[model samples]
Target chain A: MTRKRFVTLTLIPAIGLLATLALVSIAGAIWFSVMNRTLRSADYEFVGLHNFLRLLRDRRFFNALENSIIWEAITVIGTLTLAVLLAVLIFETVKKPLWRNLICFAFLVPVLLPRVAAAFIWRFLYSPSLGVINYLCGLVGIGPVEFLANPSLALISVAVVDIWQWGLFFTVILLKLLETLPREPIEAAKLDSARTWEIHAYVTLPMLKGPLISLTLVKAVESLRSFDLIFVMTGGGPGTATETLDLYAYQMGINMGGRISYASAMSVLLLIVTTMAFVIIWKAGKKWTN
Target chain B: MANITCKNIVKSYGAHPVIEGLNLEISDREFVVFLGPSGCGKSTMLRMIAGLEEVSAGHIAIGGTDVTDLPPGERGVAMVFQSYALYPHMTVADNITFGLRRQGNSRAEIAPRLKQVADLLGLTPFLERRPKNLSGGQQQRVAMARAMIKTPKVFLFDEPLSNLDAKLREKLRTEIRKIHMQLKTTTIFVTHDQLEAMTIADRIVLMRDGQIEQMGTPDEIFERPRSRFVADFIGTPAMNFVRAEIRAGDELCASGGGLTLTLSPHSFPDLVAGQKVELGLRPARMELCGQNSHNAIHGTVVLVENMGAEGQVITNVAGAEVSFVTKDFRSLSPGDPVTFSIAPDHIHVFDPETGRSLRKD
Candidate 1:
């Protein structure tokens, strides 16, 4: 068989299937964004650009957008710092395979827990009346701090659950990357008279930069559109203190307001942000790998 | 340049000892090769000398300064790893001068040294490239340049050429020898390839199981291997081994494998009557003789491997398969009758109980 025919015969179906699946989802989102479909009724009307036009004056939408940016910035930064520290600490200190694996598996428990289950677990842990966290704060003579109640602390409190789950997730991935990295360069650096911090700064961190950036971008996108944990924990709670774009959009479309087309416009904006993130990831990966 | 001396070095991991009672001294600007098979602890010794591995017991001195407790960097030694552990993100020039940078040399001071080593290794054009973009040989040259840029007092190489193809390995082996000559730094190279050790080392130290078996010039190692392991390991196609007994009658004779040879009593004074001994014969010393030749072993040819100029003929003599290289094997085939003769001076006799050569040099 000719090379082109052989390749086409083997590859066309998979590519076509993937393309169709992606097109259907994107087309569905675009179609829904312009239609006034609601959970209250099966009937819908085509309202071209009306949902997007309403968004220009929506204060709640702007609040959700700003909250999303803040939440993503906090979640991505917090998770990365904790994950890298955890990965490096366990990888460097725990020499015994059994102990290292146990530590890694323990940290990975949050990732394996269902998002709703984790949210509920943290909800109890954050309870002002009976929470272990407030109880600990009480031991330090501080009164019960309303973790998910105060307007200022609600977003950060809900975002902590994500940082917990995804921090360990990224930690496990970074640990594997650390393990797979060739160790000779570090040893060579030692023989080259590099001091401890200098070796880490010059050799080790530079080696880890590509994978670290990729993980950060991935975590950024994940936190930007995060919903289930916040929805379960605070339900965008305590006067919209933690109502990020994803949770607010979900509430508007399906649950409380039943404004499906307006929510779809917000979802389309999120999709645009995520798509831009993916492009940046792809381009960064290409640049670094080369 | 520094002369290195390792005195009664012992290295162990937990209860398992890898190197035991190892002692050696390398003179200033000498090129020495630690030649051994896998698990022989040749690399362990090299690492100990480099201060990468700590010795459980011993004193290692560099230029008469005790460096046993010193770190690798403070020992003033530079090593080229077998993996060519060049930084993937750094350009070749940056990688080469990293040591100088770490040593707190200013950028102006490092620039000329980097350029010199790059030119020396023919890596001038590749100085801007990352290691992954370069070929294997080029990467190794960059590794060499990295070590050379340090201008270290003692140089260490741990099987640096084993990662390359045959042609590249050969080319680098010559290049390494040339660099050693030009720089005149004390050098210790570890390798399992006997040919590589033979070609590049000023002195070859053959090791086995964490102990030095024999050490000498390459010619001495090839000509007068003190042990059967050394003989069997050093040559291509390996030396042929056979069991024999000393017949101390009117004239001392060694008899084995349906062949008997007269031995000079002065050479093997330790031989006694009815004593079993192991005999070693180099492939190049044996040749095919006429069918009715006197004092020859009669054997059937088993297989002939033809290599253009010389062929190796495996012969079965008294149920033992002996292989010897011969240029006259072109007409020979398996199952053919053959007679073989050995040069007397080249015969090697070892104590069967000790595996040590009985013949005195």
Candidate 2:
């Protein structure tokens, strides 16, 4: 082919892609501009900083914020640790290629399930009288204790469900990372006479640092945005238990129970917190991958 | 430090056999090299001896103790793999000390051994550096140090220098030979390079098709190969073979030759009158003989290859092409008429059907 035709062939698609991207970005810019204008013109009157300052004074907001922090902490830590453990277990145990693929496929089922559907399923399982857990406990001669109904158990119950639903997704991703890791290092560790525990502690775990940190940060972000399951299961019931920031935002913005601007402020705060977390994790992961 | 004996060793993957019953013995402090083409099962044999692979039907003994069923760690053997197999996350020091530490040796005992091996391998300065930070040669040295730290009974090398450049390979080959000589550890190395086998091994085991064709000293394997496979594999510009029939008459001669050569009455006397055979002659064994001389084969030189120190003359003889290696880079042009004769003592006779050398009295 002549150089002119070759240049035209290459540049045409590049130019088309650039034009399409520019047009899309312009549309997005215009949409954001219109939304900002609409938000400015809204009749929801608010005193300057009054919503944010009032959120600070609101006892339920404080309670929801505290619960949200604890929920995120528990979910992120529990999800990452359990997911990594499950990934490693499946990786080591599942030898048949088809079986391994099937297990990974099985783990992705929970992630694909709608959060509300999963919450409803768990709500039935966590029912005070008819729940399987209570029935099993009754086998041991225990009382039919309340799960989502009790304030003390409600947050923990919600966190457990979040972990169950999302832990497998992280495990699937981490299993991929583990599988693609260089086999030479593992073989080297074996030749070095490293026992299984030492191999996990010294070689495998250290090498998994990047994936582990990234998985934790991503799970943290996902957990912080937890909403649907809690909404379906407990509905922030039993006097503000399990009222995470996402629940708080939903309550204030859409529910008639709280102010709208204050929820927007809370969403902005969440955006800042997640952004900072991502930046920190990104920098650390970048240092490692480099 | 140890003698390794492999008796009728065999390895098979389910129905596919990798090494068909092999027997080999290495005396104490001998550097034995398993040299062969790829897929010839040399490395497989080495791994079998290292107890890394299960031996199907044989007893492998190192230092006169049966170790065929033992694990690699318990076999008193250390192997340097082709990939160097250095732990990427650990520093050179930790990598070298890992095996020793695993033996539950105290820190004091491990430190001296680690320091000794590190210093011996010139890895002291790089002890703190991780494997990825080290050069290829340095990583290889660290692998050697790691293997050597245990002072195992037998050292197995699985093409450890194949990943390096030619210059580094040569340098490391010499270093390994020196180390072997100084330490006097019975070593078995596997490589496809005959030159490396010739340079480092006290004995070379030439294998083909998952079987050892010949095992002898390098000079023996090079000079008096027991089979055509060994002859073709051991040398660079391999030996030339020509199909010829032994003639029956008052005097034995190659009848197809323009000028017939008289064979010694005592040589090849078991004479089945006219037998079809293949004549083997090393390139160096064919000398330039006078034209029209008896016992000389006349041919025309087709190509002259001058490779600096040696020149190879390719000639057409009896409708077949044959090469003659010479140190004298004569200005022989292509298509020049030449006559050559094989040195009677160096002429190898092989049974055409079996490809095995004929035993001559």
Full-model lDDT for every candidate = 0.88, 0.80
Sorted into a CAPRI-style docking class, model 2 comes out as acceptable
Q: After superposition, how far is residue B227 of candidate 1 from its true place, in Å?
A: 1.7
Provide the lDDT at B139 for model 2: 91
The C-alpha stretches of model 2 lying farther than 4 A from their native spots are: A1-46, A140-145, A150-152, A288-290, B106-108, B249-271, B292-295
User: On residues B205-243, what C-alpha lDDT tens digit does candidate 2 reach at each position?
Assistant: 999888989999999988777887888887767788877
TM-score of each: 0.88, 0.87
Please list all clashing residue pairs in model 2, or write none if there are none. none
- Per residue, candidate 1 scores C-alpha lDDT tens digits across B1-361 of 4999889999999999998999998999999999999999998898888887888999999999999999889999999999999988899889999989988899999888888888888999988888999999999999998998888899999999998999989999999999899999999999999999999999999999999999999999998999999999998889988898888689777898877877667778778999998888898888888766644778889999998899999999889998888999988999998888886778889888889988875
lDDT of 2 by residue, A1-290 (tens): 99999999989998999999977855543333222222334443325555556667889878888888899888998888788789888877887889988988998898899888899888988897789989998999886878898899988987888888788888888888888877656655666666756766777777888778777777876776678888888888877888887887788766854445566666666666767867887887788765
Angstrom error of the Cα, residue B154, model 2: value is: 1.7
Instruction: Supply DockQ values for each candidate.
Output: 0.70, 0.42
